[model samples]
Target: MILIGRTPYATCQTAANVKALRTKLFTTDGYEPRVRPIDDQSLPIAITVDLYLLAINDLSEVSETLKTTAFLGLEWEDAFLRWTPASYNKTEYAFWPQVEMVGGSKGIIMDYYEANSGWDIIDSSWSVDTETGDSTINFSIRLRRKPLYFMLSVIFPIIALAILNLCAFLLPNECGERAGYAITVFLAFAVFLTIVSSSLPQNSESVSLVAIFLIIQTTCSTLITILVLALLRLGSFDEKDEKVAVPRVLTFLMRKLKWKSRSKCSKVETEKDGKMHDSQSSLPDASESKVSRIEMPTQLHENRLFKEASTVDEFSWKEVVVFLDVVLFVIFAIILTTSLLGCLVGAQRNAVN
Candidate 1:
């Protein structure tokens, strides 16, 4: 018998035998015919058979390779019969000229191509046991995958959503859209992740690289959303609340950013100077001092009103929010860019290998 071709079913770990030919030999008893023309002589017979075969599927490199192995064998008993290489020749059973992979046409086409490995009769051998007369022929076919559809459909979209999440920081926090944008991008990432998860095999032993990348993207999106919320909280202060104190750390950061609130300090200094002037005037004429003190109280009261107005204008947390937004945006952009570049480079390297 000769093994000629096969079609592999990747998802099912099975294949359909494309072509096989069996040979049969017959012997004539003692009787002989009187005469026979060459055209009338019996010839060797050949028959073709197709059968379903179980195969081993290796998905370790799902993104790179879809390796499958099919086996063909016959069992023999020592007491009954023993098989060997051709009795007249030294060589073992020979393979057909080629084992065509006719099944490639039936395989899934998700932007990946059948890699160069193709159909190879990698391990062809006939093993025989003298004691038991057990015999077997085994051959394997290896298929490699080249992934393009997955990158385009799954990976690229996830990366784009991640980038969009990073860009949410560019929206001004006062507009109240930064958090919304981050949440929307996070939801988009979740949708992509669900799509990818549903497409991949459920019982894979290891995570796909694309899945890992999507997970990282989702994490970044979630963190960006949290950051937006935190910024909103940091900037949440009632304009009517006079006693809302800014944190010392935030105050320090504002100073570093050159956002100084000098109106309150200046107001305090002016009040101190007015007190000193009134005290000094009291050391002089009583009537003039009393008149000066009365006028001084009115001036101090007017100064307090002016100081309150200036304080309201100068003490807002808007600068802190803007600085936080800008800083976080830069950090997130760097992280996202590095992650995307690394993933691309890694994928290319895996494909090459």
Candidate 2:
């Protein structure tokens, strides 16, 4: 007797038992789920589902490699099955139904069919065994785009901003440039933070990457501000207390170079004066020796003392410039060091987590 549609086969009667056994095996008890019917009109045989439930397997390790439905065929026998999404249509999220098969001794074939409701089973496969008695297929639908955005908006931008902080070390402080540079970099990070905050969900977790970066950058900015303030205070102090001058080595070299120039000039002037006096005294006057001997030494000593005084006297402009440059360098060095260390710690913490 050949029964046409949904004939109750004795072997197939075990579908309910198989569904229960597989459900218990895969999930803990007491799970409630929605049910949706999948039907095919092309097949002469009709599938009457006695039991259906949702099944979820961890696919994080394999999801990257499984590109299409074709890949599922290669690893079909494994505990996990690959799925390629053609389209997903549901305003509200839902889970997929777990299906169980039984009764067929021969291997199951992949099937595609259209049903009366205009819906089609695009692709499916089934296998049954008397020893196994039943088998279950579990499925789930997810909103994937949200998690991807989390990685992009929060994680990558924070890292890039942190990298920018490293550039401060390359700048020199003598240009009175540290204050402006630090402020600009701080504002840039602040703008990035504003964009990040706008993108985040209000109810999102506090431990998010944006939150971490905001805290880090804010701290860095504050520290740099403090350094700038400190340097400015040092710069404002009395020159006597500040020890305001270029380094001793540079001063020494500068003095030596100037000394050589001045010595050469003095020698030329003295030679011209001596030549004039000699030519004037060519008649061998009696008092000439006395005047020449006494006045020449006195004038030479006076001129030398004048030159030395000029060389040694500290000008206000020179002190002011040196003081400002020292202050700026100190400020820049502090800011650069603090920012770099903060970035490093932030990176290491992120990596560890």
Per-candidate TM-score against the hidden true structure: 0.51, 0.29
Local accuracy of candidate 2 as per-residue lDDT tens digits, 205-294: 445545665767666665665565455455544357665443555445545545234434665676687668656755555867777766
Best by lDDT: 1
lDDT of 1 at 298: 84
List all candidate RMSDs to the true structure. 13.3, 18.7
Off by over 4 Å in 1: 1-148, 203-205, 241-243, 257-290, 293-315
Model 1, 198-238: lDDT tens digits are 88766558776777788888898888889889887777663
| Poorly placed runs, candidate 2 (over 4 Å) | 1-157, 204-206, 235-238, 241-353
Candidate 1 shows a clash count of 0
